[model samples]
Target: NFILFKTISSCLFFFFFFRSYGGKILVFPFDGSHWVNMEVLLQALHSRGHNITVVRNSKSWYIKENSTYYNIITVPVERGIDQEFITNTTSGIMEFERGALPLTSFLHLTVTIFHIMIEVHKIFIDFVLAMLNDPDFLKMLKYSNFDLVLTDPSWGGGAIFAKYLNLPLVYNVRWILAKEAHFSLAPSPVSHIPITGTGYTDKMTFLQRVKNMMFYLLAQIHYYLMITQTYQQLCEKTLGPNIDFNELSLSADLWLMRVDFVFEYPRPTMPNFVYMGGFQCTPAKPLPQHLEDFVQSSGEHGVILMSMGTFVSALPADMTNEIAAAFAKLPQKVIWRHKGDRPANLGNNTLLVDWMPQNDLLGHPKMKLFVAHGGTNGLQEALYHGIPVVGIPLFFDQYDNLMRLKERGGAQILTLSTVDKENNFLKAVEEVLNEPSYRMNMQRLSRLHRDQPMKPLDNALFWMEFVMRHKGAAHLRTESYRMPWYSYYSVDVGLFLFGVFLLVVTTVFILMRCLYRTVCKPKVKQE
Candidate 1:
């Protein structure tokens, strides 16, 4: 009986482990909202008996074994950022709280120029020091007793922490982390400043793309200098002095980005680069009964949901009115997330609110379309609910996100630059609402987005476990910084030095021969 039981248990173990699988999973996301899919990922992995842990900035969240299920755990991280930036408190560069005035335009311009120079100088020095003296550097390693580090690629800290700990890094691309990485991760194809989208599939013709490229290059320069410096400072505040950021691993073991190749702008592709486009972009739960009824009541004209995203504000009333006027004309009820400016005589069909549970609102069946500011999260939410969209891009990657959706034939993009005009705003909104093609296209994209072979949450779990099973996938994502651009291009400084040596040697030989002939010829003849 004992021999039979041992053989049976051995066979069961073989069934589980024979395929070469299982290991600890460590996830480090930028923030809590970013962790929404991560939470689901953990649950799925737990069912497979994988050990899981998460490091959120300084906080640690983990999962433990339960009788029937795995238990979730959270470890509080208590370390401070030893950072001092040019704009430490205010908009001023070099540490002064100055968005101030000289009382005149000319003086203000002059002051601003001087202020910018000061800011540049301060930023360089501050960033250098902050990177070297990061207080959280040692703490990250201590907390992350990890076999691998999974990071939101945009979150520089994750990459930095992974490098310091020498853990295998996997970049979960959400926003545009890499411009040319086959899977386009950003929002807009237009290449607007700070605004993301487009990915590799920017829809403009060659001339348009060239134009986009020009702006893209300029933006990249600005990002490398300004935004990346801030991120670098954050990395430094954690990575410390000895670790060379210039030589850190950038490519994750696998880049599990929230992208679907079927829906994205076409570009290059990588095996390790997993496109989890509509990753758990799912709604949290159902909508309220009242909100559901509001949509149900709209018979012929369905309701349109408008939101400008959480971070951006609709400050300029000009753009807001264009939206209001469009809503005013539409027969459909507009459930606008109207922040500030409570127009005394808003259309009775429009409902104004400061805070809302947006995911629930999108999930509602009666919702017809979404008028968005082209945020990635917002776009995903709309797509998740299979709602059509008219994207009015304000700034950041919102512009690019809108462009990609436009390219996919699922949504329409109206530049905010033109939104102020009454006809333009009205026409664009009309096109999105009346067009059957857009709705059909969106539904098609939704199906393809959903018909992914595996759920994003599941795919994410597979990759997490993959790292544990196969050891680290570090060699896969080659950090570009580790090799200088020139070095990567094989423009060896050593080769240049060798060329210089050869030139000098030839010159010296020519001169020596000339001198030897001149000095020795007459002397030998005389002798």
Candidate 2:
């Protein structure tokens, strides 16, 4: 067995050895979540003998000044996720498809609204900004051309940028969202699919199941209309009237889903979708002696880490107070990331700070659990380290993500709706800390998640070269690629008519034979 295993491993290594991942690459990671991951990828690619460039707008996450980056351009920000009026509007879901519109999910509703409105508002803002950037963009284009435009799926504006620049785009999703499954424009493989009527066991009611389907259709319809209207104007303003909107939407291609398949629920997906996990890792910098010592002393008793990330940091004080009290009660040491002075009457066991090295904390041997806001990046980091989670979902895809983690028995969720309640926060932390299942499940998943023979970054870089080598071959397409659900499954009005025809024919034949024997004079002979 040992000899056989060695032989197989050696053969596989040689097979992959011939593939070229070492090539010139440029990545445009517009969001903060994309920053570290892209950096990790560039470094990986660099080690593989590839040249890489990372460009950004002023809003881009902090990038080191003089690095191996072939070229780094910091463009001016015409717009950003933050806007004056946007910050005030406390909703994310906009009504279009009732199913797509979240009903029971307050968190999903809020976060969806943020994504929709910001991009909708930014369409015009980015266009005008791009025009202002035409001179600079054109000048940069002259110096170098990118083989692949790696982008965060959230940056719908980046899609436009890719289109304008005439570059092939590959997407990296920071969040685990169902939208990518249905949205044809995403260019990645559809990761999640409906379980019911489609054939799976779910406890949701028939009406509820239908509503879920409706939600998907609604979301697609909403984006379709929005993108159409927005793109039409963009064409008129930028490309003039000759180009058809439909063609542009279809022609927009290339996708790389950054999610690790092992971590998400079982679902149908396509080949265009690839994983780029572990894209977020910080460069080696020595930690402060105090920080290192803090990590060392916090032994088997376990330490809990908490953070809500930046955008939603402006949380209600009541929620903040509830969290503090909960932290004070835990047997474990708690390090909570927040802003402003520590509230009076804090406990020695609880440490409050304006910032914390979340990834680093998760990596510590003493780290017991992570209390996160359920943002995709935080969730990914938690999963990467195999640390159990206590989710306090705020908005957007947070609820769904937390739900997934909860269902998997990998985490505990404490809704923001009840966070201000002392009992609620305290109970949640206690449940997470005491529950051995969450940790066991987390470890199980972490093993499976990391079981990959090759890491996601290496896999993506390899496949990317495969794309260039194959000259954009359809080999990357999955079995799902060949069939649209309706056509492939033969579930349609046409199939219904065919079944009706067969039924009618069988019924008529039986009736005609009966009548012939009873009334057509052949009955006497038969008797």
Best of the candidates, TM-score: 2
State the C-alpha lDDT per candidate.
0.60, 0.61
- Residues 239-337 of candidate 1 have per-residue lDDT tens digits of 665554434534567777776655555555555677776665665566667666676778778788888765443435555665676678789887878
Segments in model 2 whose C-alpha atoms lie over 4 Å from true places = 1-22, 59-70, 82-133, 161-166, 174-178, 181-205, 235-254, 278-287, 474-527
- What's the number of clashes in each of the models? 28, 10
* Residue-level lDDT tens digits of model 2 in 408-500: 788877765556654877787778778888888887876777777776776777776766555453555444334456854468867898999
Instruction: Report the C-alpha displacement of residue 298, candidate 1, in angstroms.
Output: 1.6
True-structure RMSD for candidate 1: 8.9
**Error of model 2, residue 74, in angstroms:** 3.2
